[model samples]
Target chain A: MKITFPHMGNLYIAIEALLSELKFDLIIPPPSSKRTLTLGTKYSPETICLPLKLGVGNFLEGIELGADTGLMVGGRGPCRLGYYAALQQEILYDLGKEIEFIVLDHPKEDFVRFKSQIIPLIKAGGVKALAKGLALAWEKLVAVEKLERTAHYVRPREARPKAATQVLNRALQKLRHTNTVGGIRKLCRQECDHLRDLIDRNAQEPLKVGVVGEIYTILEPFANLDLEERLGYLGVEVLRTVSLVQWLKNNLILSSLGLYSNRWLRINARGYLHASVGGHGLESVARTVALAGQGYDGIIHILPFTCMPEIVAQCILPNVSVDYQIPVLSLVVDEHTGETGFQTRLEAFVDLLSRRGQGGLQHDSACISWS
Target chain B: MTAPVYLGVDVGSVSTNLVLLDAHSLEVADKVYVRTQGQPIRTLQRAMAKIARKNQWQIVGVGTTGSARQLAGVILGADVVKNEITAHAVAALHVEKGVQTIIEIGGQDSKMIILRDGVVSDFAMNTVCAAGTGSFLDQQAARLGIPIQDFGRIALRSRHPVRIAGRCTVFAESDMIHKQQLGHSLADILAGLCDAMVRNYLTNVGKGKEIRPKIVFQGGVAANQGMRRAFEAALNAEVIVPRHFDVMGAIGAALLASETICREGATRFHGFEITESVYQNHSWECQDCSNQCEIVDIVKDGRIIASWGSRCGKTDSSSEYGMLGAGN
Candidate 1:
């Protein structure tokens, strides 16, 4: 049997190990990129959110590369991401791409049906095999958590940045090549520890910056133009909204915690800000709130232009800044967000923040001697 | 001193619109549209130059809208920057006291907006389709060797508009050609193309919506009488096209600026000199991590005014700047 899962922050880390133990072949989509966007845009209705298009592209690409089964998450949210799976399935079918659509629908309301559907996919010949799969999945999840924690610090100060990246890449390569949970865990820890050591020794200064935006853009590097590393270079420590641990908790345990009464939890104040109605703006607002609370110097809300939710947030962010006294910068990305224009804005915002940091705006600071 | 005027600019892919509204009277002083020939900066500069020459009023406030709003805002020193939906809806409200619907079709994009009272209730935009946009009609007009300006007049003359496939641009193009080869008159073919585009729009862009009759079609494509006829035929009702239809986005932006000025009782418009201001951009790659976010900077007077294009906030540490001395 073949089992596949959608790429979440660290979803594969846990499930891939278990699936491998069960002897199920796995198909993972390549990292998100413009190629994925083009693929999704070519097939998807132009009106849908960018993430859905990319997800569809990712799935279709994986399928073309030789997978019959595709796993997708189902959710209910204001962002309309909840409708993506069914719509994607319909579009894929229309495009004549045949695949087993395994939608892990919200298990709370559809618990019985979800279990019934999943049972067939599981290796059901023996209970021992199921137990082994569960155990392997657990190990993989733990490894992913550790990897992410180490990754959070590795970007800004790498003793040997290339070598550290090589370690992580080597671990991923080793994991992809092997089905054994133990083998993957061994490589991940070894690589992670080596990278962690490098990061720990080379740390000089860290700038603290907050990233807030739509779930897809914030989490998906390809979508957001990789803001984290840019800030990290400016000596910023990246505080992300979607962590591997939180992702697992949201998808696994807390998913059905309040399924009937509260289907969607307003989680991740650090990034999934809530300020706008239809776009990623609200999420950016929430991120601003969290960053302000954490005493971050500045906040950047990244979102696509014409995104309704972010637009709504943009309208309210000025007010949000006034209330919190946080200087919030909104970056509306599009196909035409040329790199030069983007860099200028980043440098200016950083300079603005630096000026503020040096007590330029503080009434009490006596440093302003008008020369 | 006389109250200053507010300058609003709407720069879309196909056209650049400029509007000047009197701050006190809130009346539109003047408005202009120029084709955006793949260069928004030049179009905006040219429009600003024209408005500056024609109107002797001092600019107190600047607002921007449409697709390249951010770029325009930076270039114009805009006090207010808004999206096309808000701008269109605002302009529609100014024209019609109780506009309930707004159908906007531009060169590269199309939108369906539902309004209640003067506010936008719901809206949908089509950005990734050439099938139901002005470009589609332009292509059809060229294929038939019909001047684009006369397409509407000829389409209105058609007694029996033929049916053409409209799901995809390729299919529609092929179908239009086949109908032409089948001895259909140019007017019939043009009308058929218009009908097909409208059909495609309703099915795809305008799907699952209650399109009320108190509708106003505004945008670059709203000037096309063929589309107006097609919409009228498709809905079996007359669709109102605003007088300053093509530049509604700019009008709405002007209205927004006017409203703000009314509330604040002052204008901070940088004036027409901004048109001559040097606007430049530069970029660098962030090698901080695996995700190499390209950082972009917008420069004015050799100083970085704005910087963005980062996924993780690594390159631009605005958040950290907020907290640097909080504890000290």
Candidate 2:
């Protein structure tokens, strides 16, 4: 059975590595674009989250390419994201495009069901395939984490415009062509080193801004309009938000081992937030608080326009801002948001940060000054 | 020696406003408010012509803000290209003393900017729906065969305004028609429309926002006394409207430009002669990738000055035109 999954930033990269090891024919849908969103919206419920609409579009595109089976990840929560899989299946079936919709949820709780679902792909490779496939995907995921971190560091200080972003993109593209773990690590290191060398050492230190938001919107360039890189271009260092690797570790690996909750989310977030509001609401608050504690100059909290979880977090964020006195800009984006307005807000936010970082406004000396 | 002045231009989807500020006094010397009519370059020309006719104002710095900022900035060689948020905030602070909240309702969009100690704290804008903005008011005014200018005065006469739902324009329009069929008084119906718009604005644009007192209202819709009253009645707070209420965005842009110019050495303003130049806009499909974006190129004097509408950032206007440097 050929496998297909919706793209969320670089998740497809690691997923492709695992599926390749399992020796399954796969249809990797084309990258998410305006066209993809148009098709997705055309078939989706009007008020559904952006990721759902885009996910449905990916499947439709995959179906057009002759792929029958769909793979999606789910969560148990107050957020609407938890119910997308079932809703998507219903939506697809109503459109007369019936196919196997395999949903993997709560990895530790449903390991048997998860293994059973993907058994067809594993059996296609060989007896020793499962272990090798997991390792391959894991190696790539780790390399990507390193790569994304290095890119965030190097982007603002790069001697040439887009140098860091270009190298990161090239490195990811190179990793896709290779098959081995060593190859992946070597390419990532090489690209990171090359980007490090291109950093303008003479250039002054950059303003540090922490990007905290919903996972998909924070990571996906299309959804957030390439926010991290845009900040980098404005000469601000972006502390990239959560990666899928971290998510996997927290939800799948740690929870599967019977851990009650993520330590950081439970401990660091306790004073600020009461409970896990689901869909990263508590996590967003926790991360923002942590970033503020770490002496970051600014925090940008982004989420889908209609995201209820983030809205709850957004209301409480002012208290965090009042206590810490570190500026936080909360941006709510939908498909209908205009680029000019989005870019303007970013520019204005950066200006605010820079102004705050200067003229004796910051008494703590903890804030990073814009050079 | 000619006295230096700052030029600010706010180019929106519906209108273009130009403000000239004296450098020392920080007072507006000349102002031009004109309908854009889907032709920003030409509309700008008319505004510039009017400003230029007054005197030879030595522009030390120029700033552009609004939806068409980049386009207008590229054409005029503005020193600072600011967003509507910053510009609006700066302008509100200039006129209103200790403004805690700012309500800006323009033609197509409505926005709420919250400020504390002269720094913008939070902001929210509603552009997706059209029930609460000025265009909706304009449409209802046209349908009622009443001049938009008289809408506010007539609405204030009603003792008891009927309640009308104003979530979306489609629903609001049908509801208004239904109210008309019920033989409701025209003034009452007008008052209801104002009430509904205020309700829609508070829910849609002002959601999750802390709307504190010392509220400053601006933008074209601020011209309506009915809206001002609606806001005051709803909030139980007096909304302060500035002297240059309709052109605050432009004034803010000018103020920001003046500040930037004093700090920076040189200005990038292309000068009044840009008013004479004819700019042509054209669009073509970029088939370089699967996402075929329709790129719009603005041509000036047989040369393509700028190109946009591509998500991938393939078309570089800086290298092609080299106009951004020529001004400096």
Candidate 3:
């Protein structure tokens, strides 16, 4: 069966490796672009978040490319994401597009149904191929994550503008082509070294900004309008507070083993926000506190327009900003976000942080009033 | 002696302002403000011509700010190109050394800047909405059959102001019409509109921020005494409007240009001759990729002096032009 799934940064590279290794015919949708956004918005319900709309666009592109089945993940949460697959299916069916959907949810919820859905996909290669595919996918995932971290480090410190991004892009292209585990490992090391070598150690200390927000907006460059790259270009070192590996480790391995709760996050989020408000609301608050404690120069909170959980987090973020004494700029983006305005806000925020760093505004304890 | 002057130009959606600051005394040598009238390049040229005719000063540095800053910077050869927020904050601090807050309502945007110890502590700009800004007020004034300059005076005559919706411009307009149909006096309705705009600005742009003493109100809208009175009444605090409130962004640009020239020791000012030059601008869709970015080119004397609006950075050649083209 020909399978297709939505893109989430480099997650596609790992998924392509796994599915191809499993001997299943796969059709990867084109990278998210204006056309994808237009198609998604045209078909999607008026108030659904950006991720779901993009997913529908991916499915449409995949279908046009002759893919007959769509693959997605399901979750149980207060977030609207849990209902996206069902809604997308209805949307596709109404559009007269026929495709089988395989939504992989937590196995504990329905082990029998999960096994039934998994058996057919693995029928060709059996459990051995499944294990091998999983191993290869896992290695590639870790490799991309490492490459991303190195890119973040080298971007601000690089002697030349866009040098680190160029290396990272070339490395990502190589990783997408290379299938062998050894090839991926060697590429990860060589490219990371190349990235590090581009840095000018004598460069002035760059401002450190932590990016905390919804997972989709944080991981998907198209979704956040390449925010990390923009910050890096502005001479700020970006520290991402969310990643695919961390999320999977927490939700899949830890939760399945009944050891899911993050003590650090729980402790950090106390007094400000108690209990999971669903999605990444709690995680956003906790990470902001953690980043502040780590002495980040500033924080940028991004969320897709009309995102419920993120809206909740956005409301409470001002309090956190005041309490932590860290400047936080919350940007809500959608298809309508103008690049010029977005750039202006980013540049202003950077200027603010740099001035704060220079102690240009002498700190007066008596006159300081955030409220 | 031709005294050195730093030039600042603010090219906004509704207006273009130019300020010349004397290098020795750091005082405003001259200022020119003109309506943009949907043509920024021409508006900039006219304002520059006015300034050029007034003085034969040596421009040592040039800065540009506002919505069309990059365009103005390219055409004028600016030493520093800054955003409106920084430009406004810099201007406010210069006007009032101990200013704690600044309320700026411009043509298409409004901003609230909170300063602590003379440094910008926090700021908020209206996002994805243009309610209660200068353009909206201007439109309402025209609809009321009164010159925009008289709106503030009429508003001041009202003893009892009516209430209008300020959440959105459409709602505000409809509510104003409804209030007018209810036989309310024109002065009361105008006063109510000012109050609504102030309420909207405070709720949206000034949300959650501390409004303290030494508040400086500036921008094109700051000229409207109605808005000034509304802000004062709402906050229960006196608002200080600088003498050159309308051209604050331009003044700040000049200040920033001076700072950059002091550090860099070189000027990129193309001179006032550009004001008399012939310039042409046009946009075309690039067919290189599916993105199909609409790239705009500013042609001076048959040579493309500046090109921008391309997402892929392929058509961006703003730095290539060192001087006006041979056509000039």
Q: Could you say which candidate leads in lDDT?
A: 3
Task: Identify the runs in model 1 with alpha carbons over 4 angstroms from their true place.
Answer: A1-6, A12-31, A35-371, B1-3, B314-328
Model 3, position A39: C-alpha lDDT score: 91
Candidate 3: true interface contacts recovered? 0.25
Q: Show the lowest summed lDDT stretch of 10 residues, model 1 chain B.
A: B319-328
Which of the two candidates, 1 or 3, achieves a greater lDDT against the reference?
A: 3
Runs of candidate 3 exceeding 4 Å displacement: A109-113, A362-371, B276-328
Interface RMSD value for candidate 3, one decimal?
9.9
TM per candidate: 0.57, 0.91, 0.93
Q: In candidate 1, how many Å is residue A213 off?
A: 17
Task: List model 3 lDDT by residue over B1-328, tens digit each.
Answer: 6778989899988889999998866689888889899999989988888877767788999988888887888889988888888888888887778899999989888999888887788899998689989999999999999999999999999999999999999999999999999999999999999999999999998988989989999998998998899999999999999999999999888988888787678898888889978889989999875446667898987889888665445566737332111000
Docking class of 2: acceptable
Pick by DockQ: 1 or 2, better one = 2
**For chain B alone, what TM-score does every candidate structure achieve against the true structure?**
0.91, 0.93, 0.93
Calculate DockQ per candidate and list them: 0.02, 0.26, 0.32
lDDT of 2 at A197: 87
TM-score-wise, the better of 1 and 3 is 3
**What is the overall TM-score of model 2 with all chains considered together?**
0.91
